[model samples]
Target: MNTTIIEHLACLEINNLILQPPFHLISNIQWNDKGLSFDGDIELYSSDIRKTDFIGRVPVQIKGTTTHKKQHKKSKIKHSVNKKDLEVYYKDGNGVLYFVVTINPNTHDRQAYYRSLAPLDLKGLLDKLEANGNDSITIPFKKLDNGHLERVCKTFIQVVEKQPKQYIEASNKMEFTDYTFNYADIQEDLFDPFEEPVYIYGVLENIEIPIETATLFEIRKKDNEVITIDHEEINVEYELKETKEVVSLIIENSLTCEFNKKKKTGKINLSSIRTLGSYLKCLKLIKYQLEHNKLPFKPFEVGAKINNKKDFKNVYDDIKMYEELIEICNKIGLRDNYVFNEGENLSSLFNGIIDIFKHKKYQLLNIGDNRKLENTMLYNLKLSDFITIKVMFVDNEFIDFFGEEILSKIGGLVPKKPINKTTAEWDPNNWEEIYFKASIYSNESIKELQKATNFSFENLKLSYTDQYHDIGIDMTINIALDFVNYFDESLDSRFMELALDLIQRYLRKFPDNDLGKINLYIIRFKQFNKLSEEEQEDILEILERAENENHKNICFACEVLLQNKLKARKLFSSLDIISQTTIKDFPIYRLYQNLG
Candidate 1:
């Protein structure tokens, strides 16, 4: 009649249920002595006994008691679970299987009952507890049987996988805290006009706040006062806002922290944190403080383009999609952060995304409000007179083009390909890309940015999606300079890469052209202010080589990027006597036009 014996008996029953035949052998149960949030995990495999066949795992917890007609309900076993456990599980936003086994005191005859506490159901229960005083919950677990075993296991496994969880094992051992233990949640949703809602998830979450020195931020100085520092820079004084304690931090170009969009990656410098374990503890503390709205800033900021108030929904969708993209890096089980290298074999995750674009079709609406068309200079003159940006989303997954109902609703395609999967070249010369992903920002997104954060909001003008953008740019020296000066920020990375490729082709034919190398350096490493410190070092380092080889023109071009107007003007003045050009054609002329 011991409670411990009854508990073990219940555990044994679950074990026996898995081991016995006829029920099928695709599932296995793992039990532990004590559970924090779960007693054990139940894993489902496609095959009978291979690790590679793992579908997913369902976290399970069980309780047992001997009852002599102890106020029992029909087909139910009542049990009390820890309030803390319920809180932990509720925060996770994942499903848990609660099992209760009741044993008759005299005969030790037992019957098992189960209740799958789904995330929404947990939310409801937790909401009730939050409304009232915090207390433990007594769940009335329902009937469970051998016939229902596989169904239950698979269902909870789906629940676990579908839940938005940003999980990554630290590169080093870390302390287990709220961040490590808690389940991450999808914050909210937004809709767009041209596109239906796309569910975006964050791959990185609860990242600890890193202190940055004041010198990390710099102001563009007077032209005459431009100071150039090499790769390793000077020490800056850092004052902790909370403690007001000033400390010295040595600034290295390589140590600059920011997302590398060019490479689609990011990294956290772990030198300051002694070990990953301490970072975890700090993350827990930060999350706790942040929830209380005590923190001044988040670890990082996200910018979006939403034109109108309703367009804010479009921004939210993109945010979710970006989060999902970052999740791919986590799912790939590769590095701790995002890295998309040229020629690296794309994973199934990338395939899923490329599948969305390379295949997913939209029925071009011909009617009033639904009929959306915009002017695009790339296709304005040649390809089509009208272009409607259509984003197709359905059923939480990118639907395949097979048996699609899009045939009769017919519209024209750019350089037409089959309706199903298109193998269209991503060539810039022909403007063959019909579908590709773009990052957008808008004022409406800025408003929501205010609503979502406790930190300060800055009104940033995201470069407008240029309808005037066209390919096959003129390669003459002045025209190339116009290309870099005018379109530096708005220039698409694809277009930039193509321009660099074109420059390379030009260099091959006329191998000794300084203008060719200058154009290559200008456009290839365009937008000096935009590049991260490390990227800036790359440009400066290349310029140093040009200096060694006595490449005067190339060395001076680096000054144009560095905004050393005094030096750049001295070199440029020799060529242009008339000076008949707008700042857009040559922004280095800002030096000649403006005086301090």
Candidate 2:
């Protein structure tokens, strides 16, 4: 193998391609030998020895190992392609017309093969390309013969046409427009999925922050991002508004390409498909543009604004309007958010949503993802003792207003929210300690807690003691009581009052289980001074009539609250060990600590 002879053969192959039929047909096509910029002109197109003519100007690269295997009409030529050469090919305005031509040394019969080396095709595979230094690509070139050259030219046009007249230079405030076949005109029966999907192309200008997108349709993850459930399809006409011609040159079909310019990126969506129309996917947008007097898609020659909620419904790019909205939302510091219940009044839910988004800056409206977002928000939510949920709603307009509502129009309800929050109570005997009452409930306690928060009695759950299992109702009730206490944290008197107030309400429903109210006393004894005489008497009366060990412990706790140490010790001593010790644990344990 002589180096000079190998170079001669390479030169000979290049000459044959340039001198051949399809290659010879393309005018602006040539091969040079001496260096122009990159061994040949504009650096890559510099110097090749042979040249040719085709449908349009195209560059060519060939790969092979002198082996061919037929699979139907095409055979594979496994040869390494240079990465540098590939980049140069993509950089060219016209796509590369690459081929793998192998000539048998004995017969001198030439077999040419090719693989698509379009800009988009290379862009997608650039990351996956092997790292073999200069020769990183060992392409599997398909056999390219006379019969399929027209199809190749058609595909080449499809790739080149959608490319923005300009590749955006700056990352910010940039915009452009592109043309592609409208999917709305697609006839499913006529579509061939094997054909490469043409992208909806457009140029972007002056974007505050640039987004990576392939087409206008990609701006939305789904149709709902930019539209409501009520709207079946959003039709944005790509009009030749400049001409406004009445003579509609009847083309293949009433085909139109849509462009949806969102704040970050824009997209096109399909509305309806017709069995009657020619499949839009097959239409060559670039060819149409070349043949017609005007481009089907163009820049925003008109100005518009999306300053309000109504503006979002319309699909148009408004630069100043978008910048203004972005400024306001960013200034307000919106963050990643999940919104209000779907069942809630629309206005209230929207208010809740606006507070958080305008940021995460992801979706302008989160319509379809309501359930998934709800679940995630619930999973991550943490609430303190006060989250008053409605027991009954005459209408959905009602808010659980006992507490100054924080998370929602009213404290957002659970069933709708997680019930993992376990209520705790102070140890009755040892004022400094508190225990979780929720731990006593069975695994099904979550459903019961949801019932408590929602005040829905369906399939209520109960708790089990090692000795006796009937504490679930009590635990569930206390859990509800814990969350619904809306008293001011700083006011010990208010804390104790809320404790008593909640217990009395539950007592009305579970009168037989009055002993269950013992947990409520995490109600502060130190606040003994804060209570009026009537309030003190009411608490004392409740304790004095104690019927069991747990109840007597509360009675002893009350004696201590009144500073009657002698009576408190005596009351405690008279009880059995179980009765003397703490029975109920409350969430507001600090409210019930010992006076000492």
Candidate 3:
């Protein structure tokens, strides 16, 4: 026989051997031009009994090679397989390949050697193709003696046995009180085969009884429907004795769940569901304790009592108290319109109002602690109180618009005077003290106050003297003095104008005042020579009047404005002889001394 015929005879013999007991092979099917469509699909069966029990099927392709000789010091078996055929088998998912080689095909004493393709074996064959730059790859096969063939069959059986089971049986036992539901049944369809068993057990109770139980409930969406265990109906019920409220647990998806008690239902997202569930469980426990005339000894009962306080003092004394009330609301399925009443104390009342504010979804700009102030109180408060509180909540956008640090500093100011009096007893004049501490007279603070209060800066300026007396003038002159001392070429033009305006306003009020002239002299130092003749003469008269009056600091400050270092030094030396106080008492004395 020729080489092809000899190879065919060996394949037929091998095919007959595979059909003996545990394997059922289908052959005689037409393949493509490559040879046979597939050698056959081998179905594994249980061998202990006469009745055939199918386990799994492995689709396989077979190749035969006859030439066998030592190449590169090893037994070599060469067989050419089409590139397309190899690719199809590699990607088939259900397919495997067997390469068979029959040694000494020309002689009657031919022996068959074979190799079964494993999942990762294709990579090696592809590597061989790339290394040789060939369209087809040659695979090596081991001698397929009876012992090796038996091991291969045993391995195949083991692989089939290692797969996941097609069916699962699960059961759980649970007990509940007589007043509550005894069973829960949940049914869901999971179309995929079961890889492991699932068991769910829980006792449902009425809200009237208090009971503690732990349970796991999760929902996932698949193809637009909630799925859990392959189409299986899961039933869970908590029966309550003599209760008219109908409770239902509805699951929408992994992230969403709803609990309904009577006509009330609340949708809870994943993050808050655990707390909600715990609160509901506590409510049930509390009811049980009440019905039995017990001490309400359950931990959840104590927690429920603490969490369900209606008074504000209990909530505001602790920072995290609001979280407990929110949990109770969620557990009881409270509506969005649920009203929270004020507590007896102001702090509690504030927190109670905050609950309402949050329930209404009010967005308060966090200026500082002003978020603690309710919008309802804004219009009701006194104008001074309203303005003070309003400053605390200025947003960044308004701060950016005013462009001043003093405004932000003022906004953060708390009153140094204790709030010892009741709201009714508060004096309106107290706000002047508060505003003073807040540096309200500073131009930047004034600008920011104007923006917040809708009152003009000029109105604030006029009110400053009326409310604060000489303290307001001192604030204005001190700010002007800061501008003079720190004057630089890079100062903003608008800022310079504001400084000059402040100084001029003070001078207009007290034109010949020594402090006012000193501030003007310092501010107008660079422009002193450029002033109109009358302005220069007025300034000269103020300097002479101060000199004759022995006001050495004012005289020294005015002479420095003339850019006369010698005159400023001589005037300081003259002050040492005529003055009873030390030169250190006058800051201007030290300033001129340093300049000289």
* lDDT of candidate 2 over 80-153, digit per residue (tens): 66666666665664546665566544444556666655555555445456543334666555555444554555
- Cα RMSD (angstroms) for every candidate in the order listed: 26.8, 23.9, 26.3
How well is each residue in 180-252 modelled by candidate 3, as lDDT tens digits? 3221111132111121112222234532222222222333223222112224322222211111233222222
Error of 1 at 491 (Å): 3.4
The prediction achieving the highest lDDT against the true structure is: 1
The total of clashing pairs for model 3 equals 31
User: lDDT for each of the candidates?
Assistant: 0.43, 0.38, 0.42
Listed per model in order, the count of residue pairs whose N, CA or C atoms clash below 3 Å is 12, 50, 31
Cα error, residue 257 of model 1, in Å, equals 45
Question: What local lDDT score does residue 331 receive in model 1, on the 0 to 100 scale?
Answer: 24
Q: Is candidate 1 or candidate 3 better by TM-score?
A: 1
**How should the candidates be ordered by TM-score, best one leading?**
1, 2, 3
- Summing lDDT over every window of 10 consecutive residues in candidate 3, give the lowest-scoring window: 163-172
